[model samples]
Target: MSLLDVHRSIVVIIDLQGKLMDMIYRPNLVISSTIRLMKLADLFEVPVVITEQYPKGLGSTHPQVLSVYEKLTTKKFYMEKDSFGCCEDQFYSILKNARPDTNKQQIIIAGIEAHVCVMQTVIELQENGYEAHVCWECVSGRGEEYRDHALQRMNQKGAIITNHESVGFEWARDKNHPKFKEMSRLFREGQITS
Candidate 1:
């Protein structure tokens, strides 16, 4: 929809743990895009939620991501989940509490291991009436084939697949907007490079 519509969207970063992130290809790309998404969300005042899948075993979220969260004045809900699909009771409860007032019932998602955690979460989010949009460049798996298949399946289930920059511009809408300069600067400086 329009940038105003996407402005009401919530950003959910799932299971981007330190150990798990190390196993994925192009981890830097994922981390950079995710952090940029977080920063943009902050600028727009959109809510953000992060989840760690079995963090006790996989380890906490990467230091870079954790550092960003620490600086946010917006309350970020961080959950430790054993379930692959983060749309379970706990996360659903968080969603219920943080539900946007606008009609944009959307979830902008990014994370690690696309084939499992990200895939299952997006599927469940769609099933639960949320428009789940997955940022492709911000997600990855241990293998390219698995990541490809997961994206294909998510597309089949109606998850909008896109890249980080597109999502930013879609949300920003016009160059004349107040945040346009900052977003453009971020893009030009390669802060959100994929």
Candidate 2:
């Protein structure tokens, strides 16, 4: 499938909560990438789903990231899931409801504790017939080692590993396209500049 085919894809932001965010290494980077991803989703009119893993115990999603969602004009499905992999009943229901009736079977995912929630969800998505692609730099754990290991394991399990910019460009596909100029400007001048 094409990168810009994200219009048919869903963007899942998994478990990027308050308590977890505090413990993650490079939380700022993940948060920033998430915001960028969300912005791109809005620009492209892609569906977005966000999960908070037991928000009461873990606190809410980080304030900064949460604020971005509030500003989005696009439809967003928000859920509090106790399951690590968001492929559980509630989340899957949301996914089914939000899914565009098209050939885009891809799911672009990013979130915290890569080895746990992110890894599990990506695997489940693949098993369930969705093309799962994880944005590497947009996911992290409490330590660099843990993050590295999770990424390695996810790659081994057949997830398409990529970075945030790569995802954005893939969605844009062509420099001369209308959305291309806007997407490029947002990437080059927005908070996600790498």
Q: Which structure among the candidates has the greatest lDDT? A: 2
Computed on alpha carbons, the lDDT of every model, listed in order, comes to 0.82, 0.83
Candidate 1, residue 62: Cα displacement in angstroms equals 0.7
The TM-scores, one per candidate, come to 0.92, 0.93
Name the lDDT of candidate 2.
0.83
lDDT of 1 by residue, 55-128 (tens): 88999989998899778766477888988889778897787666645554678899978999999999988887
Report the poorest 10 consecutive residues by lDDT, candidate 2: 1-10
The runs of at least 3 residues in candidate 2 whose Cα sits more than 4 Å from the true structure, single-residue gaps closed, are 1-4, 190-194
Model 2: per-residue lDDT, tens digit, 125-180? 87777788888878999899998998888778778888767877787777876789
**Candidate 1 ranges with C-alpha deviation above 4 Å:** 1-4, 191-194
lDDT of 2 at 160: 87
Clashing pairs in 1: none
Candidate 2, residue 103: lDDT: 48
- Give the Å error, residue 139, model 2: 0.4
